[model samples]
Target: MTARDNRLHAFRPDLADARLEGEVSAERFVAGRPARVAAPVADVRRAPRPDAGLNTQLLCGDDVLVFDEAEGFAWLQAERDGYVGYVSAADLAPRAADPTHVVTAPRSFVYPGPDMKLPRVRALSLGSRVTVTGEAETRGTRYGLLPSGEAMVLQHLAPIGTVAEDFVSVAERLIDTPYLWGGSSAFGIDCSGLVQLSMHMAGRDVLRDSDMQAGALGTPLDPGPDHSALRRGDLVFWKGHVAIMTDAANMIHANGHTMTVAREGLREAIARIGYLYGGPTGFRRP
Candidate 1:
C-alpha cells in the first residue's frame, strides 16, 4: 500500500485485503464479504469512530466489499468508484441481485404500494441503483416494484442503460442543493459529489474527489487566465474545488461561499475563490 492511495485501497498497519497480499505489506489479509448499502445515505468515514471525519458517502443499494466489521462500523471499499472508508454497520445488508434501473429524479419517494396516497417508505437519491423486480400501476401512475415490497415511481427511474445527452443538464436539475462537506445525495452535496452524481446519471462514472477528478476524468485543456477557451460541459478546478461550466459565461458548483449549488458568473467566481484557494488549477473537457 506504499504507493497505492489509501482512499481507494484496503490497508492498515495490522490488516489488508487478501487481494493485495503479494503487492503490499500487512500483518495479515482477508478477502472481505460482499454487501450493499441499506440506508438512504451512509457516510463513509476516514476512521471507525462515530465522530471520525467523513471522506465520502454511499447511497442506498450501492455495493461494497466489507473487509472488517467491528466497533459498529464496516471498513469497506465501494464497488462503483473504489472509494474505501468506514460505514456504520447498521447501514449495510446482505448483497442483493443486480439492479435494473437508476433513480433519475433528484429525489424520489418509495411508497408502501403503487398508490400515491399511501404512506411513504423513504426517499432514494438520484443515481441510486434499484432492482426493479416487477411493475404496478394505480390511477394511471406507473410504479416499479422492488424486492423489499416497496414501490418507486416509474417516471423517476431510467433503465440501467439509459444515458443523458447532456451531463450539464443533469447538474442543472440540482440547483440550490445545500452544500455539505461529504454528502452523497441530493439532500446535500459537495463540489465533487455533485460532479460524480451528475456524471453517473449521464452514464459516465467518475472518481470521488476534486483532486482525483482533476487528475483524471477528461482531456486536459490549456484554458488561459481569462478562460476564453471554456465552453459548456467543461470542468474547472481549484485546489480542492470543482465546477461544471453551464456555458462560456457561467458555472455551477456546491461551494461554502453560498452553501448551496448555485450558478455564478465565471469571472466573478474565479476572482472570489482565487483570493482563498488560488486560481484554477486545471481545466477539463469530458
Candidate 2:
C-alpha cells in the first residue's frame, strides 16, 4: 500500500484485506451489529468512561457497527468515516427502518408533538439522518414525524440525497462556530471537521483528519511561492491544519489560533501560519 493508503487503512481496519487476522481484524468481527446514534450528539471516547479522552462524535441518526459492550459503553466503529471508539451504550439504538430525511439546517429542534408550544425534545445538528413516519401541520408550520415519535420542523430537513451547490458556501455559514478538537458538529468544529462537513453536504465523501484530507480529496495545484495562485474553493494544507480559500485574496478555516471558523486574508494567513505552524505544505482544488 502507498503511504496514503496505509494511513487510511490504519484508522479503518475494516477496509484492510480480510485475510489479515488480528485483534482489530474485521473478518474476525462477525458478531458486530448495526446501530444508530440515539442522542442529539454522542461522544465517542478513547476509553469507556466519561473522563476518557474524546476521540470523535456522532450526530443523531449516524450509523455505527457495535462490536462489544462493557459496563455502559459500546465499542463500535462510526460507519461514515470508519472511526473506532467507545460511546455510551444508551446513546445508541437499533438502526431506523426507513430514514428518509436529513437535517440541512445548521441546527434544529425536535418537539414532543406537532405543536410549537410543546416542550422541546432535543436539538439535532446538520447531517443528522431521520426516519419520517408521518407529517402534520400545526399553526401553518409543517412538521415531520421521527421514528421516535417526536416532531421536527420540516423546513430544517431535506430529502436524504440533497446536496448543496457550493461546499465553500456551506462552510461560510459556519463562521463563528466555536472550535473543538475532534468535533464535527456546528456547535463546535475543527479545521478538517469544517472541510469534511462542508464536503459531505456537497455530496462528497472526505476523510476526517487534516493529514488524511491533505493526502486525498482533490488534485494538487501547481507549486506557488505564496497564496498568490490560490482561488475560490481551493484547499490549502499545512503540517497539521487545513483551510478553504473563499476568493483569490481571502480564506476561511476553523483554527485554534482564532478558536472559531473565521475568514482572513489569504496572504496574511500564509504569513501567519508559516511563522506559527510552518508554511502550508501544498494546495489542492476539488
Candidate 3:
C-alpha cells in the first residue's frame, strides 16, 4: 500500500477511520463521529499531550470528525481543510454545529447578554463561526444571539456567504498580530496560517502548510532578479516560509524576524532570508 499523509487521512497503528479500511493497515477501523468545536479557539496537536506540538487551530463552530476520545483529548480531522490532529476533548461537543455567520473583525467579544457593558463571555477569533439565532437591541447597540444563549456584536459578523472584495486587504487587516507557530486567529498567527485565514475570508480555501501551498496554490510568477514583478496578493515562498506582497516593493507577513505581522521591503526580505534559509524558492499569484 502507498504511504498517505496522515494530516489528510485518518489512520493510526491501532485504529483508523473506517472510510480508509481497504487502503491502509491498522488493528481496527471505526467510522469517525461527528463533532463541533465549542471553544473560542482549539489547539490541534500532533500528539494528545498538552505539551505536544500544535499542528493547527480550530475556531468555534468548525465541524470535525472525531475518531477517538482518550486521556482528555480527541483525535479528529478538520472538515474545512482535512488536516488531522488531536484537540482537547473539552473544546468539542458531539453535535455538528450549523453556522449562519462568521466573525469578520480581527476579534469579537462574546457577551453574557446583548449589552456591550455586560461581562464578556469570551473573545472569539476572526473566522470563528456562529449561528445567529436572532438579533437583539441593547443600549442602541445591536447583537446576534447564539443557540447556547451567548451574544456577539452584530456588526462584527457577516452572513455566511458574504465574501470580501480583496483577500489582500483581509491579510492587511491583521497587521501587527503576534506571530505564533500553529495559530490561525487574529490573536496570533503564522505565515501560512495568515494566508489560509485571509484566503478563506475571500471565499477561497487553500491547504495549510507552506510546501502544500506551494505545490497547489496558484500560477507561478517571475521575480525578475530585482524581484519587482511581485504585486499585491502575490505569494512568495522559501523552504519552510511564505509571505504576501502588498506592492511591487513591499510585503506583509507574520514573521519570526519581527515576532509580529509587519511589512518589509521585498529586497530587504530576499537578502535577510537568504542568509539563513536561502533565497525565494518560488512566487505565485492567486
Candidate 4:
C-alpha cells in the first residue's frame, strides 16, 4: 500500500512504502494511549536512548498520544505539532489535567517552598503551562502552588488565556537566547520556533516549521525590487528560514548564522541572507 493508505502513516511515514511479506498489519504496533508531559521540559528524541538526537522539546502540560512504551522511553506524537518521537517515560504522565497558568517571563524558578530563599524545584521556560492548585504569600511575595505541590512566583505567570498585544514584542524578548534546531523553549529556539512561540503568546496558532508556517500564516505580500514595502509584523520567508520585520527597517530572527536571536537592518539582512541562501522567497503579513 502507498504511504497515505497506512493507518500509522502519520506516526511513521518511513515504513509505509516498505514491502512486507507476511500478514503483518500496522494496527499490531499501535498502542494509542493518551499522555501529557509532566516535566518542566522534556526532550523528544529521534531514538529511544538518553543520548539520542533531540527532535524537539515538550513543556509541562503539553499533550501527546503515546503509541508505545519500552525501556525508559515512550514513543508518542506531540499534540501541538503532530511530531512523532520518543520522550522519556518518566516525563509522560497519564493525567491530562488542564493548565491554569503559562510562564510569562523568559524563565522562572519553581521553588520548593513559597519563600525566595527556598531551594528551587526547577526552572520553567516561557510558555510552559502549569496547574495552579493553591495560592500563598511569604515575606510579602505571592506565589502559586503547582499541581506537583511546588511554589512559583505568581507574577511570573499569566492565566493561560492571556495574550500579548504584539507578537513581535514577544519575539524580541528572546533576543539573546541560543538557537537550537527544533527547539521551542526560551533556553534555546529556532527561527520557526521563535515565530510559533511568539505568535502563540499573541493568541495565534502557528505551525512548527518555516515551510509549514509560510503556507499557513498571514496574507501574501507583493514587494517590489529591494523589498521596500516591508513593515512591522511582516513575515519574510526564505527557502527554509523565516524572520519577523520589527519595523520598516529592521528584522528579528533566531538564525544559526548569528547563533542567537538578533535584530539586523532589513537591507543588511537581505544582503547577508541573499549571499547565504539567495534572498527571501516571499513576504507575508498577519
Give the winner by lDDT. 3
- lDDT per residue for candidate 3 within 81-168, as digits (tens), equals 9889999999998674479999999999999889889889789998988998999998889999998788999999999989898988
Residue-wise C-alpha lDDT for candidate 1, range 1-286, written one tens digit per residue: 2358999889998899998898888999999899999888999999999999988999988999999999799999999999999999999999868889989999999998888899998998988888999999999999999987889999999998898888899999999999999987999999999999898888888999998998888999977667788899999999999999998889999999999999999889988988878988889998
lDDT string for model 2 (1-286, tens) is 2433432232244433232245244534344688999888898788779899876688888888877788999877777887778899999999758579999999889999887899898889888888888999999999998766889999999999999999999999999999998889988998999999999999997878888778777899964664577788999889988999998778999998889999998778878878778877888898
| Clashing residue pairs, backbone N/CA/C < 3 A, model 4 | none
Each model's backbone clash number: 0, 0, 0, 0
Clash pairs for candidate 3: none
Provide the RMSD of all predictions against the true structure, rounded to 1 decimal: 1.4, 3.2, 1.6, 4.1
Quick one: ranking by lDDT, best first? Answer: 3, 1, 2, 4
Which runs of model 3 end up more than 4 angstroms from their true locations? 1-3
Worst 10 residues of 2 by lDDT: 3-12
Clashes of 4: 0
Model 2, runs deviating above 4 Å: 1-29
| TM-scores for all predictions | 0.96, 0.89, 0.97, 0.88
Put down candidate 4 lDDT per residue, 54-140, tens digits, no spaces: 767888788888867789898777777666678999997886568899999999999987888988878999988888989999989
Q: What is the lDDT of residue 50 in candidate 1?
A: 91
Model 4 C-alpha lDDT versus the unseen true structure: 0.82
CA RMSD (A), model 1: 1.4
